[model samples]
Target: MHESLFSYINQNAASPLTSDEEALIMASFQPKKYRKKQYFLQEGDVCKYVGFIVKGAMRQYSVDDKGAEHIVNLFLENWWVSDRESAVMLTPSRYNIDTWEDTELLVATVADMVDLIGKIPLFGQMTRLMDQRSFIASQRRLNSTISNTADKRYEEFADNHPKFIQRFPQHIIASYLGITKDTLSRVRKQAMKK
Candidate 1:
C-alpha cells in the first residue's frame, strides 16, 4: 500500500524520496478501508483527513434542495481525495464524499501533511504539481460545461477519460458532464454510429 504512494511520489516529484523521507511519510499516513457506499465525508461535517487512494473508486458530490445529487468529481486509484476548503479552513464541507467500491486509502491529517511538506522538499514539489493539475482540470471542465454542446462534451470526455466511461455508470457520467442521462445515451449512440 505504501509502495503505491511511493511510486506516485517518484512519478510526480522533482526528485525521488530518500529513505528517511519515506520513513517520515510512513509515520504520517495511515491505511484505511471503506466498503462500497460508505461515506468518507458527509455534508456539513468538517473534513479532517486527506486520502490517497491505493485502490477502488470514490465520488465527491453535493445534494441540491430538490435532493438531486450533482457530482463534482470522480476518483480512482492513485487519486487524492479531500474537501480542500473544509480541511484547510476548518469549515464544514458542502459536498459529500463516498466510496463507489470497496476502497483502500492512505490518509493523513492536515497537520501531518503540513509537517511533511515542510520537511520533505520532494513531497512539497509533488503536492504543488498535483494542485496545479487539479486546478487546470477543474477550469477545463467548467469551461467545457459552459461552452460545449452536450455531444461535444461527451466526445471530449470519452476521448480524454475512457476509463471513466468504462468504470462509472451512465447516469453518474451524465451528472459529471452536466447532461441528462437520456442525453448521454443519445450522444453515445450517435458516437457509436460515427
Candidate 2:
C-alpha cells in the first residue's frame, strides 16, 4: 500500500535513503480513504494533515460569496494536497479539499512531520524543495489567470495537465481554468481546428 509513497520519496530525495530511513518515513504516515465527493478538509476548519495521493483524484476549491465554487487546483496520483498555511499554522482553512473519485491518501500531521524531519534530516531538505516547487507552481497559475486570455489559459492548462483534461469532467476543468463551460468547449473546438 505504501509502495507508491516510498518510491515517490526516494525519487524526489536528494540522495537515496537507507532502508531504515525509508521505514521510519513510512511509519510516520497513516492511511486514509475518501469516497467520491468526500471531504478531507473544509472551509472554516483547521487543516490538520498533509496528504499524499496514492490513487484517484482530489480538488482544492473555495465557495464564493455568491455560493459558486472556484477550483484552485486538482490533486492527482503522486501529488501532495493540503491547505499549506492552515496545516502549518493550525489556522482554519479558506479552501475545501474533496475527492473527485474515491481516493487513498497517506497523511501526516504537523507533529508527525516534525518528528520525521528531526529523525530524518534529509526529509527537511526534501520538504524545502517541495515547498519551493509548490510556490513556483502557484505563481505560474496566478500569472496565467491574470495575464492570459481565456483561450490561452485553457490551452496552457491543457498542455500542462493533459492527464487532468482526460481525468476530470469538462465543467470541473472549466472551473479550474477560471472559464465558463461554454468557453472551455469553444476553446477545445478551436484547438481541434488549429
Q: Relative to the true structure, how large is the alpha-carbon lDDT of every model?
A: 0.95, 0.89
| Candidate 2 local lDDT, 1-194, one digit each (tens) | 67888787778787877889878877888889899999999999998788899999999999999998999889899999889889888889999999999999999887888888888877887788888998998899999999999989988888889999889999999999989999999999999999
* TM agreement with the true structure for every prediction: 0.98, 0.95
The positional error of residue 153 in candidate 2, measured at the CA in angstroms, is: 0.8
Our model 2 lands, by Cα RMSD against the true structure, at 1.2
Query: For each candidate, how many residue pairs have backbone atoms clashing (under 3 Å)?
Result: 0, 0
Per-residue lDDT over 88-185 for candidate 1, one digit per residue giving the tens place of the 0 to 100 score = 88999999999999999999998999999999999999999999999999999999999999999999999988988888899999999999999999
Candidate 1: stretches off by over 4 Å: none
Candidate 2, residue 147: CA error in Å?
Answer: 0.9
TM-score of 1: 0.98
> Can you tell me which runs of candidate 2 are displaced by over 4 Å?
none
TM-score of 2: 0.95
